[model samples]
Target: MPLTFIDIERQKNWRIVLFFLVLMALYLLAAALFFAALLPGPLSAEPRFWVFLVIAAALTASIHFWFSASNAVDTVVRRLNAQPPDLKDDVHRMFANIIQELHVVTGAKRNIRCAVIPSLSLNALAAADLKGNAVIAITEGLLSRLSRPQVEAVVAHEAHHILSGDCLETTVAASIFGTFSSAMEKVRYSSSNRLFASPAFLLAWVLLQLGYLVNLFISREREYRADAAAVRMTRNPLALAETLHFLSRGWRGAGFIGSGFEMLCIVNPVATTLDETEGFLPDLLSTHPPIKKRLEILLQMARVSITELDANAERRSGRKGTDAQERYFVMSPARLWQGPFTAGELDALPWLSPLTWVANGKGKTAERAWKDPLLNTIFLRRLAGDGRIESGFTCPVCKQPLVTAAYEGTQIVQCGFCAGTLVENGRIPRIIARTGRERPCTERLNALARSVLQQNQARNIYRKVAARGAGQVPLLPCPKCKNPMFRGFYSTAHLIEVDRCSNCGLTWFDQDELEMLQCLIENRLLPDITVAVKD
Candidate 1:
């Protein structure tokens, strides 16, 4: 290829193509010389022989290049997670800006994409699609270090890879050359002895080494092209240059891959251990172009002074009044995973059983109660079976005595004295939470409330009696509310007694009390719940 064109940013006048034409021709000549050396002597000067050799060598080179680049793409990709990104805010917006600018500056027809890795490692790379899926990934560290413009510049470069079809070239190369690289890795890893002398295979070994270096050279060329494309799009080369400078500076030893792949990223290899930047040869095959040269290109953009970005983050410290990320609580945590739907609504969801909602709801309830460190049904249920407590409970509302009824494997205490119901499931609906929001005198209620309280206190003492006697004295202390429990023969269960708590209106029952309570509620038993007529 002859010198056709080049678009230099420093002078926006004369467009020059074939800017790398000399380099290309020089590389072609070198390729020819190398092939002439590698092939057999008999066909050395033959035209048809040279032609066949050229085609074979070129084809092999193409496949090796494609596989190598593809494998590198795959390697870095496997190192990454391919999931929908939960992006950092600024980085997300920067990617958006990059896409927008790429379209505006270079008219990239495709959409830009991104993914996040939770790792705090400072690195980023672009991977071309073998199948033409141009995806650009930015790191969490990119967000932490680079300002909006710098990030935008990085994205623009990646987008440039997409826009200029560098991804196509790279993807092809990686797909072909990456296969050879995999074999290289197998040999490198499988060798038991640290070293192998290959005098007979010297040229093969050297070619293998050259293959590694060639892959790097391809990576370096793509980066330069991407860099130039990025500047062309952003018109802000300085930011990209500055971003690269700081990017490599902060990246120390982190991900431990062969440094051979370092040039594939926007910065140095994460494991880089050198400060020598001026030497071009040290970084000649380096994927990242020199920051100084890049900055020179960036100075072409209007001189913009660098201002220090704020590094001190406002972390959430659980102080009483400090501003923090605001949170919202739905009806339950189950709603969060099941997604903004009520427990009942969750029952009808596809691929989910109706019963699942129940378990998830219970788990959510337990989690909330445990986090709260307050009294709840779990503690209340602990007092259920002590003999001193009676089977019947009174509704705190109606003051009418209530009996236990099971609904769908759960117990509800329903008031006989009034039309009040306590589900005992810890869910007082909004109507309920608001209905009796006013704190009643914990000390008093009307006659109906009082009757219930009396039964409650009796139940507490009866539990104590039963726990202590185990069927003998029939009187004991209520471990639940720490109130006294005593024995009293209720007609429903004259055969046994249970414990109850007076202060907290809890009743204990012997195991059969549920049946006994049902009998009492059905008017089958004449318990000593004799009524006092109001005057």
Candidate 2:
């Protein structure tokens, strides 16, 4: 309330309240003007004039009530086509836990409901009713891409929306805009059906546009407030800033939530070029702050420079403690477990066997030894000798045999026919990092990929592919665990569809997808564990 955001100089929380009051007065004036224009010439009696004024008042009041009392939360959820999350599902459970933790931090009394949109878009929308019922709906893309801290930061941001009463205000404003827009639509329809048109319809249409703009302005203010509140609550403006920056890389899912519901989301679903002009005019009209501006303000709040943030990220990305030699146990050729050697010792062992099993930790048995992901990957690579593990199965897309190959020190499987690569779940960050360092985009693939996946063009491609049933591809079994894989877009930005195995967390990428992702990573557009998460 006291200018919580560190950078803003003039605006205060009360200014938003004052602005809403002015908007309300403007709405009333517009209603009066609408009715006055509709009046039939000079009224003979004062009572007749009063009647016209009363009718106009009633119409405006009806719209306000229609939106406010009409089960807004449910309407919003339905508009997004979101479903109640299944607690049994791992992703769903993670979301539920994050929301619960945020709720606890905020200490809000009202229970907040959560849902999943089943969308691959990386965004979250918050909505609430006048009665304090609130809900937050998250897209699957967020769960798939963002790390726990980043996600926690995002959930905290939405939670603050609920706590600070932004959801109710924004919801009411959205409802009013929608109702007025619908009224204008009916008027247009009537004009088309009529033999003669009325001039008042033009005035009504203009007024509705003004009303929607006012709602947009208020929504933007609410976003800033929520951002500040979230930082205050979580003490991690860097995470939210990184998240916003990451999301701005390419956000084309606004159409999925529809134009009417776009304002409810954390970031504008509409993808704007990172190079878009930034000034008072654009910021005044936008539903959310410019992504660059938001990042700058957040960085200011964190009291750290972008260089510091990057350095911290690099530090976090260092090798995990498993690299140490004190925890590994290898089996000898005589079938007896050897000393608790380090990872280096195990790697340097004289006789590593396909039959020989190695485990980490003191109590780990041979049965559970393979459960360690690092160990499993290392053992598998060693077993293959030449770093090619045959899957004994053919690629569904190309019908060629799949074999794991070592690339950039990571074991990834590639199909012989299409040359598509299949990578284990936790290995993506490593692959991206190594690829960025070693195979930096020498060609202008960054420019090419960006042009190909430009916001508008990418959005159109998504719509066409989604419409033609191209987004739904047949599933392929996991090469390691043999579990059924789920198919989805890798990122809405790149529009590269992939199949991911939930059981083993492995991702299969078609040939073109691997190339496309290499470009994205080289351009520093991809999310990695060291910078944003721990895998």
Candidate 3:
């Protein structure tokens, strides 16, 4: 018979009890050893001493366990700097909605709160405390990038952990010893040389090792149970499978998620060799089952092979099968009609602009390049590069005077108010090539660049699949020509959207978009195609 939530919850109670008993035993052993070292005699023969030690150990263990586990949810929230989802933000709003839906679906069995961790790493964790508090926290990077269904799958997976009572157990275990480990890490990094030889430091180190005992109790199989429960709850095994594949390849918050908390996460934040291997030792020691095995199970339930899933994911990452074969004729600077050229050839022409008259072929009516929707994107690409010269142009978005700014040794007009930039078509290549010389890309900028690229790639895939463009934002007029600029991706390959003026040969990037573009090119960050494809 399939296990229900009630059945899972009941079975977990014994495990939690066992954890407490084991914790008391560890404390008793430690106390007995400490007394033996101090007294210089065997205390095992003394019944009164044994009784006193037992009582003291039980009291100490009770205090330690309660203090650590009672406020675990709050402790985790503070440590992660997680905040409640902002209702005003679209992505955060969607997350909040999913939590509400979860509450309804689960019959409000527990009041589970939702939070968003500000880090850009992809990971999510659940925490529950003895105070009846439960929270599902997802990193901003993961939350912003996943589809609605994928997010649903992740949330359900976490929810199952909370409802099954394992989250509480894990939180308690982590709190009991993980707290000391975290403190020791800080002390080890920040303390003086003398502190390393201190007795307190040695005690903390021993406690840190004892924390690993908690991991022994944290069966890797619980993750499989959660995956199955998530599927049962969401009825979308494929979504969960895709999410796992994505997480397995991407950054999973290794340095940021903290140690001793891996058991609480959907995927082990730190991907260890043991977590990916299957053996009696790994099965006994690891906190998460192998991702490949988890994916196999989920894919089987979804009734699809790993190959088909990978292909679908590839398409979603904006990998096209074939390039479009449209050709065009152009009106040259000398006013003579040029022969039919591919879009690539048209882009190479220096004089091509919105006002340039162009024809499709023999009988097609001649029209301005800007009027041809397909050819207009060529101008947008032209604007993506860097250029300098003050033409007394005002910012399209901020209405402030544009200042000539030197970026990568080239001149570009930038808005002092909004920090947006206007670059001419000719300077983009120079700017891209000159990146990382004077201005090295910071880790924050690189992360942002990858995130923006992934978002645009997903948007592009959606546009192609739906056969429609995304909802249009208000168009910005050209600072020079006063004509509305064309808004679109820089190119199919780059996928960074920018506004270009076909008339004036200009492009505008809002705020950090220009920097993100440069960083992307410098780092060669591509769409997330590293999805695991193990059988």
Candidate 4:
């Protein structure tokens, strides 16, 4: 095993040459078979015919190889819709800084460009082409969620791949046949006809299968090598270990990242049983090793166990709550004083605001919540996240001015107090497309989603059987149009209750409803249609 970057073995260019030769052989065989089936004469016995076939196959292979490998970096960046890191943005700036730091540490071996994929998937990839262009692209979700050290570890891992020259070979391999395979997949899904029966489709499928054969040449051990190199560079095995753990539980771009690009990514975007298991066949077929094994190896290096790592993560994420010594009493909306509550508990109250009357303890003098320094931080944080811009519209529920807040890279008006959001109909698809592994679908949210779906399902059934409309519920006035909005399920398919104003083309999602809808769709949680209903 290489202990230093200088010790890493240089990739043999002959491997790429061999790959080209194999591609030519496949093309030649395919062409010969194709012509033999169509022509009646013994074409194989004719020397001139053989010569012409060889030249045709060689030309075709050369074109395919050059087209796929020449501009691979650009091809991949375009496919993922990656953009250069926004130097003005904090997170993007930090990512850019890290890439610069990587360059400095490596003595500027290669001027690797950096890009940010506008996806919410937690995956990063490195691509190097024959043009000597190399780029490291990370998803927005990963950059936002990972700490600086964790992000450094990920960048280092991808950088090592590029520096060691494996990235170029892998890019070429994925490009040659994988690109066509991915294109064919999209075509197959989009077409309504029997695309599988098409001769062109069959040929592409054959080539795609042959593309998988390239994985045989690309060793899974490269990932382990990259991981080791990253650790050597960062000198923080625990950070990478924690990141691997987080990624294992989070979404890794299953549907968003295209096929055949898995080998280039730090982790397989699409999880497979073969990827997580180890054996003779898996070793030969899988492009990545088991994440669990990787984690164990890293944890050993860090001198920590998985349990400790989990505990540390929980503490960092604030999942492990602690008992608060200082408590405050707050006046409820009903003009009654609520019992003493911790600051954390107070923050959870939707109605609690800076103007709300609060006391340090039972009989203490009541003052505005903001007067207390501890409670003021909550409001300050809220303002920082959701109060940057005040939208003209008011919240339908809170009757307070809505703030323009960023959600999934799009702007939406949200109530700072009630946390309700008002979004235009046109922006809904963009928001949903952007929502992915950024936030985990908690069990609480999942349970609420399932219950809501079941209730909506039952309600629909009752309305259909009784030949009556939905039961009357108090409708909130539309923020944009002051008219009462229609409250109903977002769709029959999703069944998440939402308020919509037909005149304004706006929708209101109360508190957690928007996240619930995103969770429902992300996990594909369906309503139990067989649920019993009572009149």
Q: Which stretches of candidate 3 lie above 4 Å from their native place?
A: 9-12, 27-64, 186-204, 319-371, 374-535
Give the Cα-based TM-score of candidate 4 against the true structure: 0.58
* Regions of candidate 4 where Cα sits further than 4 Å from its true position: 9-14, 27-54, 186-204, 319-535
What is residue 416's positional error in candidate 2, in angstroms? 28
lDDT of 3 at 164: 86
lDDT of model number 3: 0.81
Clashing pairs in 3: 382-425, 385-428, 386-427, 386-428, 387-411, 388-411
The estimated TM-scores of all candidates read: 0.42, 0.50, 0.57, 0.58
Residue 329 lDDT (model 4): 90
RMSD of 3: 23.3
State the lDDT of candidate 2 residue by residue for 1-535, as single tens digits: 4543232322335645775575566566566655654555553448877777867776776676555535778877776788888899887888889888865764546688988888888888888876667898888887666777787778878876766666666776665555556655655566453312445545655676777566445545567777877787678898888788668765548667665566678887876552244666655666676666777889999887877766665465453343334476777878888877766676677665333576667666664334455554555555467656677655655434578677777777877535678887788878767765555664666665555455434544546656644334446777666666787667655455678888877788876566567777566563221322112
Count of residue pairs whose backbone atoms collide, per candidate: 59, 1, 6, 0
lDDT per residue for candidate 1 within 1-535, as digits (tens), equals 1111123222221111221233233333334444554443543365887787667666655554445444544455565663335445655665655556655554344555565544556666666654455566666766656777777788777765555554544444344334444554565566544223322224435554554444433434556666776776666776776776566456532553234434445665553333224455545544455555565555556464333211211121234234432221233434544344443343334333211222222235413221221212222232352222323553332222345654334555543323234433142222223322332223222333344434644554565555543445535444333445644543333333335454654444443343333333333233345433223
Ranking by TM-score: 4, 3, 2, 1
- Model 1 scores worst on lDDT over the 10 consecutive residues at 308-317
lDDT value for model 2: 0.67
* Colliding pairs, model 4: none
lDDT of 4 by residue, 22-124 (tens): 7557655554444333344553376888778668766766787788799999999998999999899999999999999988888777889999999999999
lDDT-based ranking: 4, 3, 2, 1
